[model samples]
Target chain A: MKNAYLNFAQMITGIMVAVLLFIHIAVQKLGVILSFLGFKISDPLAFNSMMERARQGLWAGIYICLLAFGLFHALNGLRNILLETGLSPAKMRTLTWLIIIFGLIFFALGTYVPLVLLTT
Target chain B: MADNRPRENSLGIAGWVWAGNYTLERYLYLLHRVTGLGLILFGIFHLTATTIFRVQGEAVWNATMEFLNNPVFMVGEFLVVTAFAFHALNGLRLILQELGFTLGKPVPPIYPFKDAIRRKRLWTLVTLAAVMVLVVFFFIDFAAGGPG
Candidate 1:
């Protein structure tokens, strides 16, 4: 049952990652297109511009969603990789908890910055 | 009973890339794993970097971005883009398979695998071609002094 649940989660999150990532990349590409059309947006890496963009509702929401999906997909995928390496079941169980803890910490850290930026 | 030696694990750390006689599907699997790991590492670095803006100030964050303007970092950015491309494409392929869309239905053992492979092969090529197009654009941009 645990394995089944994990598989289901992987499938759902994998789809989310694909969709969100494509949207992210398409937005970047759109920037280039806009640049070519003589609408020179500020440097995307500029701190001010990033903060301004984060303040906007759509971009902020997309980023928060990306953060959630990206963390779950990557950490769960990492756990899957580790399990495939012939670890004992006991070690696998321990590693699973470690991954969950670490993933939550990183997710919190990641989400906090965006939330703060979006609100302020 | 004949003494049967344990078979070597070709997918071991050192051998995962170069040890196996791989089909295209196997190669795709390897690339997916490699790119996935690379992107995850980059994500960690990116999260840490972005956290600087919140923890430090805008000045520090700007300083970090300025530091990343170096040529070496530009090259790293290019590789990150490549990794993202592959990981995203192969991830789509995996998702399709998981959803029972591209893997084909179950059948008898006679040439059973070919149907599944045939169904997915076109998509694999299409995704690879899309990545190549993105790579070309990235290379052109990098050559034009863009940060990729």
Candidate 2:
């Protein structure tokens, strides 16, 4: 893709990740704060709690979306950083391909856990 | 293939750090890039550890989680929260500016230039305040650690 389109996607995915991550962090990390504010909750990081969340299809969908957006935004940002290092075109292409492959493998691994939990 | 481009102008990765005594925006630019790389590294580690441990079933996964309950990991988690707070807000500012939403009409080049910094000072302050608020929240939540 052209740089313009890539940047546009980066911006869009950034916004999406920000929104989705707010949800993820609030649920996973701020359980104590939420409970303090009168929400009935427990240790969200506990195995049972995490498994319960993973069992839900909605949670799986959210996790999948977060994973996709987060991975792209992150890896692309890394690419941009590396590109600014005055790399040659051939080197840049190689780095881009490497980043894409790494992202794909990470995404496949990440998606599996939630999918398995939701399906099983 | 020896590609000899003019390298004098290119600061390369060094430009991202210790280039000069830059303005607030420039400093934020450095912070943005650094925090971005940091977050990506953290994501890689977190994903790999969780994936490897998780595929082994609940006992193994729980054991890994137990391992992460140490003070070192707790500190790392807190840092992630702090970094996310800064990166997200600064990124919002960057998005708005890049989209030309925050910038007014282009005035002719004149003396006593009212630069973009002046135009964006409000946004910069707002972003910083928001980040500070989030850091405070993270500090509290970290101390509490899920239902304290």
Q: Each model's number of backbone clashes?
A: 0, 1
lDDT of each: 0.75, 0.84
A1-120: candidate 1 lDDT, tens digit per residue: 566798788778877877887676544433565467676666666667777787898886787788888888898889877866777678878998998899899888877877777778
Docking category for candidate 1? acceptable
- Misplaced by over 4 Å in model 2 are B1-9, B105-113
The candidate 1 chain A region of ten consecutive residues with least summed lDDT is: A25-34
Candidate 2 similarity to native, TM-score = 0.91
Clashing pairs in 1: none
What TM-score does structure 1 among the candidates reach? Answer: 0.84
lDDT of 1 by residue, B28-121 (tens): 8888888889989888887888775544768888778777788897788779878887887777777777777876666676754465666678
Clash number for candidate 1:
0
